[model samples]
Target: MKRFFLQILLCLAALMVLGGCQSKSEIVKLPRPVGTLAVAGFTNPMFNWELLAGYLPHEGQPVNKRVIRELDQKLVQTLGKHGVTAYARPAITRQCQEIEVFENMGSKREAAFSYWISVGECMAADYLLVPQVLFWQPHRGMKKPNYNVQPASVVIDLYLIDVNNKRIVRRIHFDETQQPLSENMLEAGKFFERGGKWVSAMELAEEALDNGLMELGL
Candidate 1:
């Protein structure tokens, strides 16, 4: 019996080691110098009507405009910490409008690509950073509620486009929904990081942004 128990412990240890070596964020391609990037701001999944026309069944709740603005500011601040100079939102809007690209955004892939390049040129930026919010579900407060409460959930995608080449150089996609420790042993670290309590949607997104950028070497 003792030998059998020892073998079980060894198996668990092996599993833990394997999980620790796994990458948390999905990254495509390699990172490049972001010299003066123009942040195109975060896009709402709901507004991408053209792309979601046939996929409405898979869509999640739309995030509030205020929440998006907060996340955008956090992204800019995070970029600054990584030594990347980013253009503010107002500048992006002004430049896009000046180039007549604001009105045609998300209409077509080709048009969007041209618009990104044009906006980058107008802002004198080398790259354009675009973020899209896919899902957002805020967690209830610490105070116990009489009703059932759902944990925070968020999904975000980041794209780093080469303005001159008009191509995506790097991309990071983060999707996570908090679950009880019993349900997912692989996420034990995250559970401890959150103090074993529910976290807010903004908090989850902030963590995702930080991790995703780090993975991209930004």
Candidate 2:
């Protein structure tokens, strides 16, 4: 009888573990936005980007440009794939550049929201998708004889705003952080040494968008 009880307890514990795993893997669905969606691509906001460059290698210019182009393409494709009826509007894109050049939000969150709302209104879009590159930096990894390791880090922020309501419907953020490894010497070094291949900002942006879309259940 005692042995039988032990076996039953073990089975119960296994079931509990499986149940916990399933709960953790449950998919989270994002509320689908209503009406037309316009995507606005980014241009390097001089202040933020310039400051970020101080920490990364190669001045970070190449990555910045690539990120802008890739993000625009990826966002439209991703949103369309998920049945969001999204398009990148040149008018709004141009306006975003103008705002970055002339206006400085300087940590005022509402000011940024108001700008997006106005853009959506001007474009006649019901929702505006705003994506920003928070950071892109390539660290150095052994490169003297033959490049053995290369790694990079990137951060992206995505926002979906309702033009009619002047409200943000979805806000998503992503980070490309290096993970630690124990077995492989190269990967382990890449994680700690802050060194790796110079990854383009565009590539990082594309990854961030892809991740965000997946998280959105798209």
Candidate 3:
């Protein structure tokens, strides 16, 4: 009967939908390196405010130095749990100054690369781990869920450099901006995982840190 066929089609569609919902993307693991790693800590991007007027508000706020220090320590501790020896060097003002000199002469990327190499030599670390905070927008209201409030957003990049080889061992980039389930259906699982509550910038960054490290197999 036509009605029976319609019901069967609907059931098949429902099953297909459920299957899609349960599917998850696989995370590719990189080779784990041997030897100790020194965490270089987080750094803020240097942007020209005049040229990036519209983007200033989103990324202009200075991340607290204390927060940076805490993240560095957290990374070191996380590595320790994985049986990886690591140390944190949160104070990098002098290193930044040296990098600036290179920046004045050439591209910022090149300057950073050169600085990192020098840092590895100075620390005598077999490897160096650098974490950079690209953008951070904290929740406006109380660190709890408020339908009327904006959710936190953050972007972080982690790099593991093989000091002796002068090459990158692994890199992970995390960029997350919390949005309502209605806005991004793909993140429905994450929404429910967070209990449908908005989180703070710190919370988001911490999640990113953990996920990044895990993806690195650390």
Compute the lDDT for candidate 3: 0.65
- Residue-level lDDT tens digits of model 3 in 1-218: 99899757754554444434532235565556577656676766545331101132344667777777777767667677666654544454236334433334355555666677677766677877777776777788654544688778887778777889887777787788898664665665666567767877888887777767767766
Q: How much lDDT does each candidate structure score?
A: 0.67, 0.56, 0.65
Clashing pairs in 1: none
Off by over 4 Å in 1: 1-34, 47-61, 86-99, 102-107, 141-147
Clashes of each: 0, 10, 0
Model 3, residue 94: distance off in Å is 8.7
Q: What is the TM-score of each candidate against the true structure?
A: 0.72, 0.59, 0.72
Of the candidates numbered 2 and 3, which has the greater lDDT value? 3
- In candidate 3 the C-alpha lDDT for residue 189 amounts to 62
lDDT of 1 by residue, 134-165 (tens): 87888875523223568777878777778777
Q: How far is each candidate from the true structure, as Cα RMSD in Å?
A: 5.7, 10.5, 6.9
Q: Model 2, residue 100: displacement in angstroms?
A: 9.5
- In model 2, the clashing pairs are 63-201, 66-202, 67-202, 139-195, 140-195, 141-195, 150-196, 150-197, 151-196, 151-197
